[model samples]
Target: MWMLVNANGYTLAPDGGNFSALVMDGGQIVAVGATDDVRLQYGARVDRVYDAQGATVLPGFVDSHLHLAWLGMQMNMLDLARATSAEDVLAQVRQRASTLPSGAWVLGANWDENRIANRRMPSIAQLDRAAGGRPVMLRRVCGHVVFGNRYAYEQAGLGIHPANPSDGHFGRTPSGDIDGYAYEGATTLLERGIPAMSGSELERSIAAAIDSALASGITGVHSEDVRHVGSLYRTMDIYHRLQAQGKRLRVHQLVGFDALEEYGEWLVEQANKQPTIEELDWLETGAVKLFADGSLGGRTAFLQHPYHDAPTTRGTAIYTQEELNHRVAQVRKFGLPVAIHAIGDGALEIVLDAIASVPAVAQRDRVIHAEVASEPLIRRMAALCDRMIVDVQPRFAASDLPWVEGRLGLQRMPYVCAWKSMLNAGLYLCGGSDAPVEPIQPLLGIHAAITRRLPGTSGDGRFMNEGLTPYEAVKLFTHGPSYAIHREDRKGTIQSGWMADLTIVDTDISNSQQLEMIPRTCVLQTIVGGEIVYDRLR
Candidate 1:
């Protein structure tokens, strides 16, 4: 047994209080209480003890939504997210181009046109010059759009003038030539020409994400990987290997979204091949993922009305009402819970109606990015106990909220990120960083949730009244995710009989005055299953 003493701990219990010591043995917390008494009883037999040095400890963060594969992909790829202008991005691209073999693909991710000082999308001619004649592809931060160089267009077999898809688009110049821009599924055309990652390369990336998560004090993550990178078997293979190596991190993977016929067939084919487990403790999946719409940042999110800024057009819809209902019901027939990406209000209405149509087949069905749901939609979601959950990224506010108000206007801003209203309406809320989309750091998430402001930025919050309290905000990353996933009884809290996963920090979060420091708060230690996985002070 081991004890963590000389500190403050927030249990996230219904009847919350301060605890001084946390005692654990064999991957379970044995006791938690005042240091003097609990230590007096267990000190004699305790084999090891961690002195907190008067810091604040809490249950380790459990992020309910993120793409670990994508995060890993970003870690090793060309990152244009920080480039201040188009020229800066091109300068970096040229540097990369100088090193790669000619004709080899140059891939990049996280490029946002809005962040560029000129606010201009890079043109194909500019990209060609930057890549020095090599094929180049880069995805927008939202992953809904892509930019490619002339060589990439040539490799993809695109013609001089390419017609756009009915649901998505490709940019064209005044001369009617392909502009090397692709939106939505059209981006996949260019992607197909790129080489796929090797199995060992994928394992290395997943391993990278695991180490990053642990270092950030994350104990568990509800991740989506197979959809973007490789096959489900490939994704789970590395996870199983990690478990075999005794490197365990709680992961609830959501099956990738694809066409109804293909995804359905693959599910049954992989069922018998899946490795049997004593319980779904380390890695498990019973949830099927779907994409209902695009992202707000890309101006592709389905909305009832046209964007206030882009009044000429409303956002794109991945599926219509009937299409969604029919597909959702068919997916439910397989007995798998569904999680859909529904960012705009139009998508929410259709998704909620779809879930409502299906009689409760599972304990939880998730609404990823319920970013903009209206009042009536909230009420309807409350009625549906298909246990529909709202998986949100508060840090998204830090990024999107800055310009979302301009797109939505004041009349619509209040309804956006109305987390308080959703809770009052009896809807469940869980937090995720949508990492690589946002940083996967939970303290930054907590800061964003409570403050609704970008860390280090000085101003009134984007929507100050929509912000959550410190306790409520913390729950988004803790009990809220556990309950959403139906694992609350065993995880998500620091208490007796619960899983021994704790995150220790050097500051008090409950003080309210310390809220601004939440993002800056450093992780002193991360303990997972009674074992020290990450310790910075050491």
Candidate 2:
């Protein structure tokens, strides 16, 4: 049966003119043109007609980078994101401690040292007092560092003495005692005590993440939580069952590089077992993700110069160039794409070199969080053209802008978040919210790209000169990401023979002034593969 969808405004194709109506049959767009033309073609045989009621319909958002399972787990954990001071963090910890078992591990995330009143890392004594000797680990907002209580340190069998702190350091006092601040490798000490989620719990979390994305107008995402690999298989099974009963959401999974050794053989075997396309348009494996360095927030982003705040120290590198090159070569040999986490200038250079080493045929090599790329590297990236994809988070400008200027200094600030440069260089730009790091809402990201200002700030907007137009921002979240994952032929734009994945909003977002109000605009509906998975009106 055919479905005719008529709207007041819509972008029918990336380069084509807007249209008033579209027709879908068998989960694929059959035609996109005038309402009269669509109605005349399928008016009599149409199973249903959807009126957009003047909303602006466009391609559904594609979040190319995110950890869906972890975001779900965050919903149940103690949220320290709102804690404004060290005292506030301790108070929340103490309040939650009273209800838990005496020896239970207290794990929480989303705390920033810059936001805390003290402007300093939390101490072991402070966490110990709050938790009453229970093992506790609170991750910084960046997820690259952790603050642990004395009990956690003891449980992990770590001593006060720093063990080759260069790799990652444990915060210590003048007298050589653990101060609870764990940077880099030191964070692993607390990971041992955190309990793993059951299969059912994992499925629930994945469902919650999907629902959350739908509400935010995110129809699809490329997930990177390898820790939940088992959970992914379980979630896929559950999704298959749900679809059999007629329900499911679209998802694309990417395995992390760390698990490549343990699961590489399995993925190679399962690649042949992939279900037919008709059975599932909602999930697929697109790439292998690798981390080249840590995060900017932790000052471990692997840079050429020392951190502005910590002049004595440059950032840390998670993997050597030789190791990364070997891994990329191995993964490329399997015909799978590779996406590397690279935030700093030095890290980006290394990843780019590794890509250069790969054969030209092995394309779609992505650099996630290409936040601080240099001009030379941008030129090198341009040479790859469509082969190189950049997965960037625009929302970071609002949260990290305050500290970014100080980190890179005024001279280098202009080069940061170089979206315009990438576009000018002819490279594909894929926008994403590394959710749990930033909120998963695409509009927030759109707002960031167009505004380039921190929340509640009135100053000449930070990097206002570098901001992108609303149309470009929307394209980044839509066609750009689809091209990144090599799915532009099937997803991305609303054209004939393409998957009917789309989002409808109340306002015209192409205008810059209109973008400021995007967050308030309602997502009237989200359709995936011709199925009305999320409809606000209903």
Candidate 3:
């Protein structure tokens, strides 16, 4: 039994109220009220009393989207996320290749051409020169495109005139020669040649990612790791083993579409049994994650019209509408909802139409990254509020606002990352970092939601009318996530019988000044199930 007192707290309960103290026992919030009242009832039996010193306390923040295994591996890769120019990226590659053994593959990630000085991708020759005879492959920030040197293609069994794969194409110069860039499915061709990590190495990376998330005050995450871990059983077994070490992050594991066969076998193995409350508290199966299209940054988001900047193409769709419909039906047989990634209007329309065709798939269906939309599409989605949830990355507005208007036209400005409009239309929104694509800090996401401006900038925030209030923005990581995972009754609040997951910050977020400085707000403690997982004070 433990008690937390002298705190400014928001319960976020059904009735909507506040509390000054919380009493927790056996991983549940047993009592919450005034400090005097709570102390009078449970102070005698409490084993410890934590003083918050009047800091703000709220439900633990949860990331509704992210790739755990990928983020872990990216942490160790050559980080080019902050490279300023094409030359800067090549310089880093050159530095990385110098330390590697001869012929070793030099890997890097997160290079954004939009942010670079020349606003261009490094050429194959530049990469070849930088790598100094070693093979090299670097992923764009969006993860939809990759740049490689000639050595990499040759090592992957592709000759100079290698044909494009059926699912995707390699970038070609005006003369129809390979340009060392791979789109979507073409990335698999190069990836197959890279060495796989051993089980111990993979587990270490997963553990590091989880600990990093916990340090950021993220007590839980909806993570997709089956594909990265290589199998459904391995993904589950890894999480189960991690939980045994006390104070682990809660994970809602999503199975990838590629693992459906293994998922079916695993489902049948446990068809007759029921999961215990403890089993759900640590880890549970989420929905099937399927990519409907690529990313906006790569101009492969399957837009309804050609991109304003690139008038030649409307972008690519990984699956045609008919294919997506069939896949959804296949997933329905397992009795689980589907979380579809639809970033552009074209992809969103196809996803919506597919769901409308099958009402069963609509129930608890999640539309991930519904980034581009028109008024009509918003209205159509509003009608399905009872059966759907839109998982959005709030920081996207902060990161994409500068170039979004150019990619989409000025006419499409109002519809770009219209989060406030979505909320007003009665749509349920869950927030996420989409880490490695964006930073995994919830406060940065909240700040982005409220400001809608790039960090360290001055002037009216872009699309100011579409910004959320402090409280509403906070809910994106709190109440909204609990509802998305179907654990609203047990996790989203600090009420009696609710899980004892609390995040303590040094500032009261209700204050506009404090909220505006959210990115600088210090997290004093992060507690999950009544156990302190992170303590800066300690």
Candidate 4:
């Protein structure tokens, strides 16, 4: 019942023919053609009209990976994502601590030490000073390490000294007293003690996250939030409620292994009854996630070779090949899409071998990071594209660059962020922000992809050989992701049969000149299913 006209938008074709108008009715695109052509058919019945005002219009972005509940929790908690030094982080903690009652837990994340002057984590004594006798649980930028204050240790019932336990370690003082840093499973001590969000609180977090995503022009996200929030059933119930209440953002939920183990029978029943994706829907849950290894920054990623910087240790592998293969087979048999974290080449090979052990399926089993993919793996993955995909974060260049060559060294540098290589290898390359890890802005990721360098910095990129064109980068967010989720038929483009999930930007993003300033180009409006979900102009 609406028409959008006079936009400098493309139909997303190879030639990208100029289009002047679009028609929408019943929350779907009815027609797209010249202004007169669209009006000739629906002129009399159209209830409202909108003008693009000469801005660029494209498909709404899809973040192939991210954590929503964590994003929402960060919104409610203190944010030290921008802290550049240990003192700066302590200062932020001290400020937040002053407002809280004594013994309250201070929670936040996105703490990157690379930006710090000395690039060192703050000590427990410093955190104690900043936290004012309160418990503090701050996740590192990588999410693999958790920093806690003395009160956190006290609350966990561990005395002044705690040793390495289970699959993780705690940094201890020379005298054997517990330090702030906890790694891998050891961080669970702090997390397990934190209170879970109430039902109402979870709803609020989901709503806040949806609004934020819409404002960023993200119509869809593949979210892994079960462990970050609570039970899978509870989260799904909340999503259903939000959908019934008319939430617009599309959600592709990633079920945790724990959730599958706990509620396998119930989930199987629900999957059978899940609605078809013939039309654009608000929420769907049919994906399973497994962690193959830790993170590059955390130095726990399972590398085939020892890290150049840390040659003494290779890293952690959460599951053996047999174990991972068994889990993959189980999920595949249950008709669930699976995505495994594989940052290092060692982890990538394991996932590939496991998937290759079984016949190919169209479920789009994926290697989530594959950051350190090798030539052989690339070739094999290309041969397996009919069954698998690679979901990568372009903005990782911003964080990993300047040091990637140090950790990965020269031989592996070419393979890192080799999106074009992935494409050439016949792999579908979807992009994401990995928000809370990287900023959730689609433009930021695009800028990183097209430039492979931080904004405002010099040169084509640190790795100019690895850069992707602006159009190709955009497609990673649109076409690539759509294909990965089996919605390429209707979700990723601006065609007559496609859903009317469109994003309007203030500038022409495809222009190479604009790539330099793309991060500054704001989302003028985000339309989902022909309804305006976010409108800066309004």
Candidate 5:
């Protein structure tokens, strides 16, 4: 029983038209038309009126992949994402350590070595000097690698040369000594020592992250937080509690692969109870999240060919083909889809093979971050697109495009971050931020999707042909998500009978030139399910 007027609305429907007004009742859109006509028709019954002030209104943005608790934790952790040199990182670590007690751990995240002046991770000795005996662990921007000081290793209950994980390794000196650098599975060695957040802390962190997301115009997120909270039960409990407390952020919770057994047990409990209608709308179980490989920036994404920049390595694979197949089968037994993180073509190939081997799981799988792929891989992926979803982080192009060509070579450049190609080949793509790794703003993702370049940069972007049109780019966060989650009939558009989830912004993004303004656009209001969850004016 509310109305929004003065909006430059992009219905994103068939024939693609604009409307100025919309009506909602009982959390569903009831009507949409010219502002005067709708206002005249519904004026008597409407209990509230929202003035958009001629701003643009589109479908609510949904982040297809992210870690909720971890993103919230990053809000309080040391931010090294902007550091430009090794010295800058060391200086920040020193400053953070100075504020903490002598033996307390100083944890930080999101430091990219490629952006540093030296183009290298700082040594353990350098970290030790900066930390001044305090335990310190700094995660690389990719989150697959971590560099720690001596005190950190000791505090983590590890010796100078702890056993390397079966799935990953520890960086070693020329003479074979541990170098305080852990990659892939080895990162758990350091993480196990970092104290776990209590239930209240986790709830606060999730709330803070949701506030940030809603402010950025995101109405929904498919979050993976089981590992961050240290227990699947705790993570699900917090989300359920938050929903009952009237939090508007819609969360599609993805259980981690390690917690598959727990998820199965939880499913039995769910079967015995009837969830309320509000609970169904606010929170729902998603697929089991699995990592097939690491990240491109960390040189750990399993590639078909060795890296051009670093010829000695072809990147690390978290699981062999046989193992991945086994895990997918296990998830199938629980009757849940699998969302596997596979960035490079090598990992994608293995994942495709695994899916192809399991006939029952073929179209039900989700490939997260297919950042690098060849023609054959795309074709293979398209074959399963009947129900399969490819979850992509559009913002990654803005950050990774500058150096991805160097990691991969000119020959592979055409296939890297090729979104348009995938779309043209009939693949269903859903956009995300991978926040704490990238910013959570959906507009930033839209900007990157259209420009294929950094926000302020000019000229043709790298692989400009691979870029999507403004409307197509916007769809990645809008209709794309609804399609991915099988809610197209009720969400993703502003038509009557659809769910009333709308993102109102300051920019009218209808064409290519207007895309430049997206990076600077401010979200005026975020309305989810007929409720104004975030309003800048208020």
Candidate 6:
């Protein structure tokens, strides 16, 4: 059945002017033109007609980097995103612990040491007392760091006496006693013991994530959660089942690098067992993800120089340049694309060198969270053009601005969220929420990109001098990201022969406004595959 959607204003393409109407049939956009012309062509055959009532309609947002299952799991956890003191964190932990059964793991997220009044990582003793002996583990906003109570550590079989840290570290005092904080590789101590979600539970969480995303105008996401090596098959089965059920969300799953090494043979075998690309239309396999460094919020991002506050420590890197190059070569040999998680300048340089080693023909390789890219690196990135992509989270700067400035100093902080610079340099940039770290709202992200201020910043309302225009910001979330994942031909823009994935907004977002008013710009309707998945009017 055909559908005719007439809106007062419609962005037919990222840069395309507003249109009055669009027509869709069999899940594809059949035509987009004047309202009267579209009506004259398909009005009789159309099964439904939607009146947008002067709202702005555009392509549904494409979030390039997110953890769908984890975001869903976070819906039930303690939210400490705005806690101003360590006491606030303990209080929230204590409250959650009081209601839970004995021995049940109490996990939480979004607590940052930088924001705490004491400016210290939470200790095991405090959490132990808060939990009254119940095991507790709290993840930092970046998800790269974790803090555990003594009972939680003991349950994971970690000893009080600290051992030599591996690629990542377990925080310790001068006396070599475990101090609750665990970074990167060390997070596995507690993560290994946490109960795994069942397939049904995973499905439910994914569905919840999908609904939440649709409500906020996100029709597609590139999820990068490759479960543990041993559970790869089970996780893949669950994903396959979800796809078979005709899940509303479009997903581009990137296989974890850990699985590539631990279960390489099995992964290759499974790849061979699966049908060719044509047969597996809903899923694409051949993208390997690697974490080259930790996150800035955790103060673990690899840096060429020491942090402004922590002068003695220069942060850390997971793989050396040579090692990364070898891995890149190996992945390319297998005809797979590589997506490296690199946040700091030093880390990005390492990844860039590895990318340069690969043949230029391999397109769509990306640097996830290319946050602090330098001028030279930006120039090199421009050379790659369509081949290199960036998955950026604009909201992070608004929330982390104060702390980031404090850590990097004012001179270096301006370069933290370099969206405008990247755009000017001709780099393909994709916008993502990095959910569980930030709320999954593309509108909020778009606002942050253009304004560089939180929703309620006082005074002149300028948080960062370097910011993007709304038109450019919209491209980052839509066409820019679509191009990154090689989906521009089918999605990203509203054109004839494209997928009918779109969002209708209540206001014209391109217009300048007070920072506070940005979040209230609700998505009135979200349509995917020619179906109205979410409609505020109804």
Find the 10 residues in a row with the least total lDDT in model 1: 256-265
Q: lDDT tens string, model 2, 117-197? A: 867645678788899879888888888888888788777777566474545777778887877788776676556656667
lDDT by residue (1-538, candidate 4, tens digit) is 8999888886675545668889887768888888888888888889988988788888888999998887877788767777888888888888888999987788878787777778887888999888989889989878888888888888887657776675677878888788788887788776776767798898888888888899999988889988876788788788878877877888888888778775577666666777566432567665689888888888888899999888987788878899988988887776677888888889888888888887656668888978888788899889888888899999988668777787767877877877777887778889998887888888899899888888888776766767888878999888878888788887788888688899899989989866777989999999888889899988
Each candidate: RMSD:
2.1, 2.2, 1.4, 2.0, 1.4, 2.5
Model 4: clashing residue pairs? none
Report the C-alpha lDDT of model 5 over 1-538, residue by residue, as the tens digit: 9999988999998765899999999989999999999999998899999888899999899988888899998888899998998889989999998999888888999998888986976788999989888889888888899988888888888878888887888888887778988999999987887877778988999989989999999999889998888888888789878877777888888899999998998889877897875566678786889899999888999999999999999999899999999998988888788899999999999999987777554325689999998889999999988868899998888899899988998999888888898999999898999887899999999999888888899887888888988888888898887777677777887899888999999988765667778899999999899899999988
For model 3, residues 1-538, the per-residue Cα lDDT tens digits are: 9999999999988796789999989989999999999999999999999998899999999999988888999988889888988888989999999999999999999988888986887889999999999999999888889888899989988856778776677898888777998888888887777788888888888988988888888989999898788999988888888888763799988898999888888888756567787777788887889988888888889999999999999888888889999998888888878999999999999999877767564338889999998888888889888888999999999999888888998998898888888899999999999987889888899989988886688776788999999888889999888898778989977899999999899987756776557888889889998899999988
TM-score of 2: 0.94
25-71 in candidate 6: lDDT tens per residue? 77788888888988888889888787777788888788888887788
Measured on C-alpha atoms, candidate 2 has an lDDT of 0.78
lDDT of 5: 0.87
Better of 1 and 2 by TM-score: 1
Candidate 4: stretches off by over 4 Å: 13-16, 158-167, 174-176, 271-280
- Each prediction's total of clashing residue pairs, residues at least 3 apart in sequence or on different chains, is 0, 0, 0, 0, 0, 0
TM-scores vs. true structure, each candidate? 0.95, 0.94, 0.98, 0.95, 0.97, 0.93
Off by over 4 Å in 5: 276-278, 361-363
Backbone clashes in model 2, listed as residue pairs: none
Error of 3 at 290 (Å): 0.9
What's model 3's overall lDDT? 0.87
